[model samples]
Every structure is written in structure tokens, then in C-alpha cells.
Target: MKILIVGGGMGGTILGNNLARRLAPEMRAGKVQLKMLSASDKHMYQPGLLYLALGRMTPDELYRDQVSLLEPGIDFEVDPVVSFELDHNQVKTKSGKTHGYDILVIATGSRPVPEMIPGLAENAETFYTEETALKMFKRLQAFQGGRVVIAVGVPHKCPMAPLEITFMLHDYFKDRGIRDKVELHYTYPVGRVHSLENVAKWAAPEFDRLGITYETLFNMKEVDGANKVVKTEEGSEAKYDLLITIPAHKGMEVIESNKLGAGGFIPTDKTKLTMEGRTNVYVIGDTTNIPISKAGSTVHYQVETLGENLAAIVKLGSPVREHDGKVFCFIECGKDRATYATFNYTVPPDPKPPTRAVHWFKMAYNKLYWTSARGLL
Candidate 1:
């Protein structure tokens, strides 16, 4: 059997590496084939981008070549996938080439859709993508003082990213002796500051201590760039000097055109990561409508599970395991400190509350994860 994995992201690359090493003997004996399709040659350490935007890390630290990262035996395709022909069990690329596969893994991660929100295209700045992060960094460097509003858009990757931005901004101004000059506000559509109520319980105290204003359950309707104002559904207006907005996110257009699931996200059995209607297709990462925080760690766990199940299917022709809906995240709260939270559908039923030890654990885990992945630690 041949496996075709699309989008060499955290999920794709990690799973590709795992499969390549484990299946090398079988592949050498002509038992199976593995191929990875990616849109770009660059493999970025995306979690590091948050530090880069905060002026704590450099861009060079986030760069790695995709070819160099993967094992030599895995075939790598550098092309953009334009469509998925589910009927033919094939995928068509922008270059007019088609790939047929027995099993297809969709990891074509989500992207920010700034145009989906009015006035965001013209006035609002963002830090979702690397390009936008760098642009916002430049703007932040030159910003003297103003009402800086950091707003969280719907269905964004990394639910705590907005809070990270807010904390980093507070630290930035404190260092520049302009903490009093800037009025920082964090607005979210959710009923709480953090998506998880347990985290929100801790976050509330932090926001109060930082003197940052917050509005929960307020959905941003439009950004009146001309007047430097943000309008919400509650008929409330917020004036800002700088607008850092997280726009709506969506799955790849190919998935959307195929009518995969509600809002373009593929509906998958949470444990299996298999596409609901199709037997041969499986999806991992942010492309699936999983009821969990869409973070890199969540993808890592899903990919590990997927690799094992795929191996069982190819070799034993039987399903082996189920996903536990486990997710963990390290939320950086500035001051050289962070907090870690772990949650599973069965346990606690809420994000584990943060502790001072979890904060240090987050700092240490960053090094541990990077080192393990890069073979440094």
C-alpha cells in the first residue's frame, strides 16, 4: 500500500519521520511506499514565532529545510495541492499533476482569513502568520503610546495566543517606561478570558494585577479604521491606536470545495482521525473539527496515534487504537514565567488549573521538546 501525506507541518512532518524510520525495512523490501507533499521548502518551528514576535527570539531560530529534516527514503513533493478528487482516490496539484494513494492523510493546516472580517484588510494588523508577525513586530517597535487593543478572532489556532500577546505587550511597555502611557485591552468572543474556564480563573487575577481591561462575550463586528474604532454586537465602541486582531481561520479551499464538513473543517471521528464519509481518507491537526484546543501538542499526540493505527492497517489489516482527545499547552504569562495545562475528555473535564510549578515546567518543556525534535538535548 502507498501512503500520501499532504501539508508537511508539525503533524505531517513528525508522522512522516516516525513512519519513515519504522517502515524503512518494509519499504526497502517493496512492501510499502510513503510520500509527503508540501507547499514550501521551508519548515518553520511555528511555536518559536511567538517568541520572535515578542522580540525574545530571532527568525533564524525558526528556519529549517524540509528536505533535510525528513529521512532520505521518504519521497517529498514540493507543490501546492489544488484539489482532492475523492472519487478517484487522487489529489491534483496546482502544477496539474495527480497523485494516487491507497491511504491519504490530510494535514493541510488552517490559515488566517483576514478578509472574512471587514476593515481588517485595511487597518487591522495581525500576528497569525510569520509575515504578519514580523510586520506587527515592526509596528510595535515604532509604537510610542496609545490604546492598544488585542482582540481574539473566532476559531483561531492556539487559543491562548492572544493572552500571550497581551502579556508580552505589558512587559514591552513596562521595559520602555511607558506602561502608564498605554492602555491595553483584551477582548474575546468567549464568555471567559481563556477558552478553558479553569485557565480563565487564573487569568482573571493576572489581568487585574496587570491593570489590563478585558471584555468577555463581546464579538467584534467591524473595525472602523477611519475613526480608529472597533464596533461590537453589543453596540459598544472601543477606540484604539493600534489594533492587533486575530482573524477567523479556515481549512484549505480544497477541503471546503469537497463539502467535507461544517465550515470547511473535516468532521472526523475524534479517536480515529478518519474522514466521516470516506474510508480511505484521514485528517489530523487543525483541519479537523475536534472539540479540543488546536495547538501543536495536540497535533503531536494525534499524529503519534495515527502512525500506530496506520501501521496496524497496512500490516495487520485491523484498527488498533483510539484517540483520547488529549491536549496540553504552555501559556507564557511574561516575567520569564509560563504555565502548563493538560486536559483529556475523561479527566477533570476542564483544563488543569495552573500552578507555579507548571510555570517552570513550561519553560523546561520548551527546551526538552525542541531538543528532542532537533536531536540537541
Candidate 2:
């Protein structure tokens, strides 16, 4: 039995470690082999990117060598996946290598699509990636703002990140004595500040208290970069001296090229975590069309359920476990305070108010995340 895992992000690396440990007996007997294929040697601690813009973290701290993060006995290859022969259970890489697998796990994850909106790629700035986050930090520092807008296209990873950045920006500007000089604005496609109604309700008062302006149902249509303005499909316009936009997100190109599902996302069984119409293939993380926020917390919970299910299938010929779609998010409120929320697919989060202790907990969790990825925590 051979397991091929595609991707080495938070979900892929953790799943590889879990699978390596669970299938150790088979591996020792030469009955099972585990290999991971990643596009790059870098595995980023993405959650820390939020703090990177706030000067609390650096780029070096957010990334580790991907091969070093894998568990012992797991083979790792650094190559770009060109296509997947799903019917044949084989994957082709850019280096013209083909690999066959008894079981395949697609954890390729999501990426920003700035090209989805007109003028967005040329005009807007973002902090979703380490490169972009650090660039935005410099832009924020040098901004002599008239209007600063934080806008999202749609369906981005880390549901709370834009809000956290908005809060941090308020603090960032105030500390620099430019709070009143800059008007902070946030725009989202959804009708609420957050996807969850209850979380949005909680955030309403916080937005008011912070003096941040928020616009709902503002589906960005185009960016007039030359004029320094943003126009939405709903016939609204905002002039921004500096624009920070969370570009539209999409699943991996390999998935799309193979026609796995609409928009490159696999339509997966929410509970079973298996690809529709395929028992030997599993899908997890942002690659799945699951109605959950594409956050590391979601992946963290999915990993345990996936590991249990995969273990059962490999050893017993069937899966007895089901995922609960549980996730938690820690929202930074700046001023060294943060709020925490926990929920599942069936429940909406009723977050606690901001607290300084939770802020420290979030900071501590960043260090724990590194060890956790290495399967030490």
C-alpha cells in the first residue's frame, strides 16, 4: 500500500505525520509507503502573517523548510504537480515524473486570485502571503492616508483576518498620531461584518467602539487604479488613497485541469471527507467545497477525523469515523487584546469579549504551531 499526499501546507504536513505514525507497522513490513509531494521547500506558518503586518513577527519566523517539517520515514519530493490522472490513480509532476498511489489525499489548498477582478492585481495591496504581508507593512508605515479601505472579493481563507487587520490598523495609526487623519473602512460581499450572524452581531459594537466604518454587500466589481477609486457591483464607489484587498480565492489549478469539481474544488462528503464518487480518494482543507471557513483551525480538527477514517479504511477496509466540522478562531482587537470563538457546522460562534490574556494565548499558540507541525505537541 502506498499513500501519496499532494501539498505540504498546514493540512498536508500534519496529515502526512499522522498517517506516517498510524501506518508504521505496515511501513516497517514494507507493505505501505508514504510520500509527500510539495511545490516548494517552504512551509509557511500563515496565521503569523496577521501579526507580521503589525510588526509583531518577521518573515523568517513564518516559514520553515517543508522537508524538515515532515515526520521520519516519510518521503518528500519538491516538484510542481502538473496534472492528476484520477481515473488511473496517478499524478504527473512538472519534472515529467509519474507516481502511482493506492490512496491519494488532495490537500493542495486555496490561493489568492487577484486576476478575478479588473485592475485589482495592478492596483490593490494584500497581506495574505508572507511577501505581500511584509510589503503591506511598509506601505502602511509610509501611508499618509486620506481614506484607507480593507476590501474582500469573496470566500477568502481565515474568516477573521480582515477584521483583525482592521482593528490592528486602528491601533497602528493611533499610535502614530494619524488615527484621525486616516478613515478606516472595511467592505465585504456579505450583508454582515462576518459570515456567522452571531459573530457579526458581536463585531458590530466593536466596530462602533473602534470608530471603523464597515460596508456590507459591497461586491467589488472593478478597481480604478488610475483614479484611486473602487467601484462595486451594487453601484457604490469609494475613493481610497491606499487600497488593501483580499483577492478572490480558488482551488488548485491541478484540480481544475482534471475537472475534479466546479472551480477546482472537490465536492466532498462533509462528514466522510471523501471525494464524491471515489472511495480511494480523500479531500480535505480548502480544496474541498465544504461550507466552513478555510482556516487552519478547520484543518486542525479535520486532520484527526481524517486520520481516524483513513486508518480504519487501511486496516479494516472501512471507515467508521466522521468529521464534525469543528473550528475555532482567535480575533485580535489590537491594544494587546484578543477574542476567542469556537463552533461547529451546526452551531454559530458566540465569542467572548476581548481580553488581554487571550492575546498572549494567541501569541503562545504560534510557537506551539511550529512544534505541532513537527508532531512534537
Candidate 3:
């Protein structure tokens, strides 16, 4: 059996490594072949971009050679797929090669589209990618004191990033002794500060305690960069001297061009984790239109369930696992403290207060992510 994996993001890496370990004997016996195709040879720990923006981590620490993280039995390549001819059980790659597979897993992932909002790309600072994070860091360094506004959009990755950055900004300006001079304000699209009800409930008081002003029901329409104002779809405006934004996200352009799913996200079965209308093709991570937070833990958990089911299919000729929508995230609260949220489909998240221990553990996990990707943790 030829198992082809597309995209080398978090979901792809873990799933590739997991499958290699589970099907090692089959691979050795020439019964199963696992191969992965990615856009780059370097694998990035994406969550570290948040810390990179805060000057807590460096660029060198965020990357590893993709080959170093995979198990021996898996074949890895840096060529990206340009066309997905699912009907033929094949994909055409940029390298002019067509790869066939019995089972295909698409984890092409998502990208933030600040350009979608008029003038947002030129006006606001974002930390979603390495280039943007570095620019945002420099912007923060140059910012002395003014109305610092955080504008959030929907379907973005790392759901807690806006709140985490807000708290971090409070600490940042406080450290610079400009806390009194800076007016930290946050605006959200929905009526609540967060999509998660309990998280929104927990964040409100935390914002109050930190003296961070916020306005909900503020959907982004466009940015008046010259006037230093953000016009919302609701017809309200937020004035700012410095604007930080968590822009909306969409799946890869290849997915869009292929007409896989709306906005590039592939329609996926919430429980089976398979692409709609195709049992042999699977979807995970930011690629899936599952209406869940597009966070790393979501990818991590989905890979776990997929690895088990794929292995079960090889061993039992049938699958026996369902993704439970499990997700976990560590929310940095600044002040060297952090908290976490864990939830599944049946259970809602109830976050606890920030603690230094959890913060340190999150720090440790940052280093251990490579091990986790190797299917060792």
C-alpha cells in the first residue's frame, strides 16, 4: 500500500512519523510505503512565532531540518503538490512527477490573509509568520507610548494569541515604564471577547485587572492607515497610534484552485477525519473545515487518532478510532505566568488561573516539540 501525505506542517509531520513507527514491519517487508511531500525542507515550530514577536525566543530556535524529525522508514521530499487529481488516486508535483497513493492525507494547513482586509497589510503589525513576527517585533520596539489597539478576525490559528499578546503588551510597556502612557485596547468580532464562552468569561476580569480596554462586536471592514483608525463592519471605529491585528485565515491556494473546499479548507468528517465523499482521503489540522480552533494541539490530537486508525486498518483490515475534537492550549498571561485549556467534543474547557509552573512546562514543551514530532513523546 502506498500512503501519501501532503504538506509538512505540524499535522503532517506527526502523522508521518506516527505511521512510520506503526507500519515499520510492513515497510520493511515492501508491503506499505509512507511518503511525505512538503514545500520546504525546514520545519518550523509555529507557536514559537508568538514568543519571537515578544523577544522571548529567537528565529534560530524555531526551526529544524524536516528530515531530522522523521522516522527512518518514511520518505520525505520538499516538492509541493500543484494539482490533486483525487479521481485518479494521484497528485502532480512541482517537480513534474506524479505520485500515486492508496491512501492520501491532506494536511496542507492554513495561512493568514491580511490582504483580504483593505489596508490591513500596510497598516497593522502581525505575528502569524516569521517575516511578520520580526516586523511586529521591530514595530513594538519603536513604539514609545500611544493607543495600542489589537484587532482580531475569525478562523485564525492559535485562538488564545490575541489575549496572550494583550497581556504580554501590558507587561511589556510596564517593563519599559510606559504602562501609564500606553492605552492598550482590544476589539473582537463577536459580542464576546473570545469565541469560547468560558475563555471570554475568564478574560474579561483579567483585562479589567490589567486596565486593558476592550470592545466586542467589532468586525473588521478596513483600515484607514493615514487617519490611524479602524473602520468596522458594524460602522464603529477604533482609533489607534499602533495597530496589532490577528487577521483571518484561509487554507492553501492549491486547495482553493482545486476547488476542494470553500476558502481553501477541505470539508472533513468531524469524527472519521476523512475528506467528504472520500473514505481513502483524510484531512486534518488547519486544512479541515471542522469549526474547531486552528491550534497546534488540535493538529496533535487529530494526528494521534489518525495514526491509530491507519495502523488498525493495516493490522485488522478495518479502522477503529474516532477523533473526539480534543484540543489543548497554553495561554501566556505575561508576568512569567501562564494557564491552559483542554477540551473535547463532549466537554467544554474550564480554564484555571495562571501559574508559573505551567508557564515553565510550556517552555519545556517548546523544546520537546521536536521529540513529539518524532513520535517519541
Candidate 4:
């Protein structure tokens, strides 16, 4: 059996390692083969991008060699898959080579497309990537003190990011002795400040405590960079000296070019983790239209179920279990305080108040992520 895993993001790398270990006997016997194809040779701990933008972490701490995280016996390559010939049970890579597989795992992650919103890319500061995060950090440093309006878009990664950044920025400015000078404002597209109801309930009070004003149901329609104003779909405009936005997201371009799903997300079975109508082809992480927060923890739980099912299929000729939509996310609430939300499909997250201990744990997890990527945590 040949297992081809595409995209070396958290889901692919961890699942690859998990699958490789579970099928070690078969691999040693030459009965099975595992290969991974990724666009980059370095794997980034994406959560760090938030801290990077806040200047809490350096750029060098955000990456590690991709191959170092993968388990042996897995043939890992940097050639990116440009074509997903799912109907033909094969994929074509950037190097013009084709590879066939008995089972395919598509974990190609999503990308933030701030440019999708008119004038957003040119006007607002976003921290979804290394370049953007560093740039946002610089912008934050130079801001003298005025309206720092934050707007959010749909289907973006990390449910708590907007809230997290807001809270962190409150502390950031306080540390700089300018918390009173800067007025922090947040805007969310939904009726509440956060998509998760409990989180919204929790964060609203936090916002009030921090003196952060917010406008809910405020969606980004266009940014008038020339006027330093952002017009919303709701016909409201917010003027800002500095604009920060959590832009919308879409899956990899290959997913779009291959006509996999609308906006590049692959239509995936939420429980089975398989592509719709295709049992042998699986989808995980940000690539799947799973309607969950696209955090590393979501992918981690998805991988837990997927690795088991894949190994079961190889050994027992049948799969076992289903993904329960389990996700665990730590909410960093600045001031050396943090809290977490852990839930599954059937449960809702009821996050407690932030604590310094949890904050330290989150900080420790930043370094321990590589170990977790190796499936050891």
C-alpha cells in the first residue's frame, strides 16, 4: 500500500509521523510505503505569528527544518503538488512528476487573503504571515496614539486571535505607558465579539474591563485608505489612525485550481475526515470545510482519529472511529495571564478566567510544539 500525504503543515507532518510509526512493521516488510510532499522545507509553528506580530517572539524561533520533524521510513520531499487528479488517484507536482497512491491525505492549509477585501492589503496591518507579522510589529511600534480599529473577516484561523491580539495589545500599550493614549476598538462580523458564544460572553466583560470599545455585526466591506476609514457591509464606517484586520482565508491555490471546493477548501466528511464521495482520499486541517476553528489543536485531534483509522485500514482491512470535532485552544489574555477552551462536537467551551500559570504553559508549549509535532505529546 502506498500512502501519499500532501502538504506538510501540522496535520500532514504529525499524521505522517503517526502513520509511519503505526505501520512500521508493514514498512519494514516492504508491504507499505509513506511519502509526504510539501511546498516548503521548513515547518512553521503558525501560532507564533501572533506573538511575532506582538514582538513577543523573534523570527528565528518560529521555524524548524520540516524533515527533522518527520519520522524515518517516510519519504519526504519539498516538491509541491500543483494538481490533484483525485479522479485518477494521482497528483502532479511542480517538478512535473506524477505520483499514484492507494490512499491520499490532503492537508494543504489555508492562507489569509487580505487582498480579497478592497484596500485592505494596502491599508491595514495584518499578522497572518512572517512578513506581515514583522511589518505589523513595526507599525505598532511607530503608532503615536489614536484609534486602532480591529476588524475581522470570516473563515479565518484561530478563533481567539482577534480577542487575544486585542487583549495583548491592551497590555502592550500599557507596558509602553500609552494605554491611556491609544483607544482600542474591535469590530466583529457577527452579533457578538467572538464566534464562540461562551467566548463572546467571556470576552465582552474583558473588553469592558480593559476599556476597549467594540462594535459587533460590523463586517469589512472596503477600506478607504486615502481617508483612513473602513466602510463596512452594514453601511457603517470606522475611521482609524492605524487599521488592523483579521482577513478572510482560503485554502491552497491548488485546491482552487483543481476545483476541489469553493474558496479552495476541500469538501470533507467532518467525522470520517475523508473527502466527500471519496473514501480513500482523506482531508484534514485547514483544507477541510469542517466548520471548526482552524487551530493546530483541531488538526491535532483530527490527526489522532485519522492516524488510528489509517493504520486500522492497513491491518484490519477496515477503518475505525470518527473524528469528534475535538479542539483545544489556549487564549492568551495578555498581562502574563492565559486561559484555555477544550471541547468536541457535543460540548461547548466554557473558558475560565485567565491565569499566569496557564500563560506560562502556553509559553512552554511554544517550545514543546516540535515535540508535539513528532507525536510525542
Candidate 5:
């Protein structure tokens, strides 16, 4: 049997690596073949992009060759997939190659589309991509003191990133002795600082302690770059000297073009992690339209059942598992301190207060992520 996987991001890499390891015996016996397709040759540690924006990590340290992360048995293709012929169980890529598979996994996560809002693409600064992160770093370096706004867009990959960057900015300006001169503001589209109500309750005190202005229900409508103003859908507006935004995110154009998405997100079975109608097709991570944070930990948790279910399908003709929707994240609180929280479908997140230990743990996890890519952790 042939297994085809699209995308080489965190979810894709982790799933492919884990699956290859689990099916090693089948691979050796020529009973299964695993192939991974990616649009880019470079694999970026996405969370590190925040540190990269803060000048805490270098570009070289944040990226690796995509081929280097996979085991020897898995086939890696560096080609952009243009279309999916799901009816035929095949995928067509820009390289004019067609790959057929008995089972297909669509871990092709979401991508940032700043153009969704008028003038956002050309005017606002972002840290969602390597290019944007590097650009933001330069902007941060030159920023002396003024109104700084950090806007959190919806359906973003890292829900904690806006808060993390905001806290880091507190430290960044404070270290330079311009903390008082720089007025920091954090704007969220949701009713609170975070989607998770409990997490938001925990973060409120921290934001207050840091003297950072927190604005809720501020959905962005358009950016008046020429005026350095961000206007919300409710007609509220804020001016900024430097605007750091997590622009709206959407599924890849391919998924939408292939008619597999509802407003750019794939509709899947939350319990079984399978495509709505397609048999032998599965999706995880940011690609799914689940009402949970699109985070790496979410993928890690889903993989627990996803891996088992896929294996069961091959051996038992059906899956016997379900996704728990477990997700957790460490929120940076500046001054070398951080906090953590865990949540799932049925439970509310209980956030741990800021501590130096959690901060260090996050730092260590960045290194360990490499191990995870190799299916070792």
C-alpha cells in the first residue's frame, strides 16, 4: 500500500515521521511506501520565528533542510501541489507529477493572507513568515519610542504568539530604558485577550502588571497605512508608530480551489479525524475547521489517536480511536518568565502563573522540537 502525505510543516513532519517509524516492518517488507510532498525545501521551526523577530534567534538557527528531518525510508518531494484529484486518489503537483496513494493525509496547514484586509498587505508589518519576521526585526531595531500596537487576528496558528510578542516587547523596551516612552497596546478580535476564557482571565492580571493596554473585540476592518491608523469593523480606530499584526489566516489556495474547504478550512470529523466524505483521507492541525487553537501541541495530541487510527485501518479495516483536542502553550511574560496552560474539548484551561522554570522549559523545547521531527520524542 502507498501512503501519500502533503505538506512538510510541523503537523506533516510529525505525522510522517511517526508513521514511518510505526510502519517500519511493513516498509522493510515492501508492504507499504510513504511519500511526503512539500512546497519548499526549507523547513522552518515556526515558533522560533517569534524569537527571530525579537533578534533572540538567528535565521540559520531556525531553519533546516526538509530532507534532513525525515527518516531514510520516506520519499520526500520538493514540489508545490497544485490540485488534488481525490476521486482518483491522486495528487497533481506544479512539477507535472502525479502521485497515487491508497491512503492520503492532508496536513497542509493554513497560510497567512494579509490581503484579506484592504491595505494590510502593503502597510502593516507581520511576523507570520520568515520574510515578515526579518522585516519586523529591522522595524523593531529602528523603533525608538512611540505608540506600538500588536493586533491578534483570528484562526491564527499560534494563539499565544501575540501575547508572547507583546510581553517580549515589554522586556525589549524596558531593557533599553524606553519602557515609559513607548506606549504598548494589544488588540484582540475576541471578547477577551484569548479565545480560552480561563486563559484570558489568567492573562488579565499579567497585562495589567506590565502596564500594557489590552483591547478586546477589536476586529480589524482596514488599515490606513498612509495615516498609520488601524480601523476596526466597529469603527474603532488606533494610531501606531509601528503596527505588528497577525494578519488573517486562510487555508492554502489549492484546498479552496479543489472545493475541499468551507471558507478555506477543511471540514472533518472531530472525533475520527477523517475527511467528511472521503474514505482513507484524514486531516489534522491548522487545516481543520475545529474550534480549537491551531497549535503544535494540538497536532501532538491529535497524533496520539491519528497514528493509532491509521494503523488500525491498515490492520483491522477500521479505526477505533478519537481525538481529544488537547492543547497547551507556554505564554512568555517577559523578564525571563513565562506561564503555561492546558485545555481540551470538555475542560477549561487552568493557567499556571509566570515563572522562570516555564520560560526555560520553553527554551529547551525549541531544541527538542528537532528530536520530535525525527520521531524520537
Candidate 6:
């Protein structure tokens, strides 16, 4: 059997390695083949981009060659996928070639869809892509003082990122002795800071302490760049000298052309990572519309379950592992401090509230996680 994996983000790369190692014995027996397709040769450590944007880290620290990272015995393809013919179990690449697979894993992840919001794509600058993010970082450094608004667009990857930006901006201006010259505003479509009440509670006090103004349940509709104003769905206009917005995120166009799910995100069973209504197709990571935080930790959590289940499917033709929607986030609050929050789909009896201690733990975990993943210890 041949397996085709798309998109070499955190989930795809890790899952590819896990599956390659797991199926090595099967490959020796001529029973399995694994192939990974990615659009670029550079593998980006996305979470680190946050630190990079804040000037706390450098770009070299967040990038690795894709060819050097994949596990041995897995074939890597550096080409963009143009479309997927689900009925034929084949994918067409931008290079005008087609590859067929017995099993396909869709991990193409989401990208910023700024056009979803009127004038957003043309007006406000975004930090979703590596290129745009670096540009924004430079702009932020030169910013003297003005009405700086950090707004969250719908279905964003890493739900806490906007909040992180807000906190870091607060700390940035304060250190520059221009905190009073700048007015910070954070807007989100959700009615609260975070979807989880526990997280919102932890974040609320900090926002208040920082004196950052925020609007909840306010969906940004248009960015009137000519007037330096943002209009929300509630008919409210926010004036700003500079706008840093998180644009709407959507799955790869290939997934949408194939009619996979709404916004091109594949619908999957959380436990198995298997694409719903399809046999022998699985999806992991940010490409799926999973009701969980779309972060690297989520990818790591899903990979283990997906590997075991895939192995079970190969050995016994049945899934033997279940996935628990467990996710952990390391939220950087600037000033060299961060917070750690872990949650499962099922509510915990006692959710550990966020604390300063969690901040230190988050910093420590970053070193540990990167070292482990890169085998650099």
C-alpha cells in the first residue's frame, strides 16, 4: 500500500516520521510505501515566529531544511498541490503531474484569507505568513506612538496569538517610555478573550492591568485604510494610526476544490483522525476543523494517536487507538515570561488557573520541546 501525505508543517512532518518509522518493517516486506509532499524546502517553526516578530528571537532559530528533517525511507516531494481527485485517489501537483495513493493524509494546514473581510486584504497589514510577519515586525520597531489596534480575524490559527501580540506591545511601549503615547485596543469576534472561561479569566486581569482596551463579540467588517478606521459588524468604528490584524484562516484551495469541508477544512473523527465519510483517508493538524486550539501542541498530540491507529489499521484492519483532544499552549506574556495552559475536551474537575509559575514552565518547555524534536539534546 502507498500513503501520500500533504503539507510538511508540524503535523505532517511529525506524522510522516512516525509512520515511516512504524512502517519500516512493512516496507522491508514490500507491503508499504510513504511519500510526503510540501510546497517548500524550508520547514518553519511557526510558534517561534511570535518571538521573532517581537525581536525576542531570530529567523535562523525558526527554520530548518525540510529534506534534513524527514525520517529516512520517506520520499519527499517539494511541489505545490494544484488539486485532488478524491474519486480517483490521486492528487495533481502544480507541475502537471499526478500521484496516486492507497491512503492519503491531508495536513495542508490553513492560511490567512484576508479577502474574507472587506478591505482587510487591501488595507490592514497582517502577520500570518512568514514574509508578512517579518515586515510587520520591522514596522512595529519603528512605530513611535499612535492608536495601535490589534484585531483578531475569524478562525485564526493559534487563538492566543492576538492576545500575545497585545501584551507584548504593551510591554514594548512601556519599556520605550511611550506607553502613555499609545492607546492599545484588542478586538475579537468571540464574546470573551478566549473560548475557555478559565483562560479568559486569567487574561482579563492582565489586560486590565496593562490598560489595554478591548471589544468582545465585535466582528471586524471593513478596514477603511483611507481614513485609518476599522468598522465592525455592530456599526462601531475604531480609529487607529496603525492596524495589525489577524486575517481569516482557511484550508488549502485543493481541499476546497475537492469539497472536503466548509472553508476547505477536512472533517475528521477526533479520535481516529480519519476523514469522515471516507475510508482509508485521515487528516491531522490544523487542516481539520477540530474544535480545539490549532497549535503545534495539538499536532504533537494527534500524531501519537494517528500513528498507533494507522499501525493498527495495517496490522489488523481496524483502529485500536482513540484520540483525546488534549492541547497545551505556551503563551508568551513578554518580558521573558510566558504562561502554560493545558486542557482536554472533557472539562477537568479542577482546571489549574494560569499563574506566573506557568510562565517559567512555558519557557523551559520551549527548550525541551525543540531539543527533543530536533534531537539536539
Please give the TM-score that candidate 2 achieves against the real structure.
Answer: 0.97
TM-scores of the candidates are: 0.93, 0.97, 0.99, 0.99, 0.97, 0.92
Pull out the clashing pairs in model 1. 338-359
- In model 3, where is the ten-residue run with the lowest total lDDT? 368-377
Q: Show the lowest summed lDDT stretch of 10 residues, model 2.
A: 368-377
lDDT of 1: 0.81
Model 1 CA lDDT for position 46: 73
User: If both were scored by TM-score, which would come out higher, candidate 1 or candidate 4?
Assistant: 4
lDDT at residue 4 of model 1 (Cα atoms) = 95
Give the per-residue lDDT of model 6 (tens digit) for 80-143: 7888787899999989989999989889998889888887777676777677778778888888
Error of 4 at 122 (Å): 0.5
Distance from true location, Cα of 314 in model 1, Å:
1.9
Candidate 4, residues 123-142, lDDT tens digits: the string is 99989999999999999999
lDDT of 1 by residue, 90-176 (tens): 999988999999999999888888787788757877877788878888888899899999876788888878887888789888998
Per the 3 Å backbone cut-off, how many clashing residue pairs does candidate 3 have? 0
The per-model lDDT (C-alpha) reads 0.81, 0.87, 0.94, 0.94, 0.87, 0.80
Candidate 5 lDDT over 1-377, as tens digits, reads: 89898989888888888888888888889988999999988888889888888899888888889889998898999987898998999999999999999999998888898888887888878888889999999988888999999876666778888888888999999998999999999999978888778778877787898899989999888889999999999789999888888877899888899889876789988888888998788888899888888888888788778877777777677888778888888888885999888888898888877899999999999899888777778
RMSD of each: 2.3, 1.3, 0.7, 0.7, 1.3, 2.3
Whose TM-score is higher: candidate 2's or candidate 6's? Answer: 2
lDDT for model 6: 0.80
Against the hidden true structure, what lDDT does model 4 obtain?
Answer: 0.94
Off by over 4 Å in 1: 349-377
Residue 264 local lDDT, model 5? 72
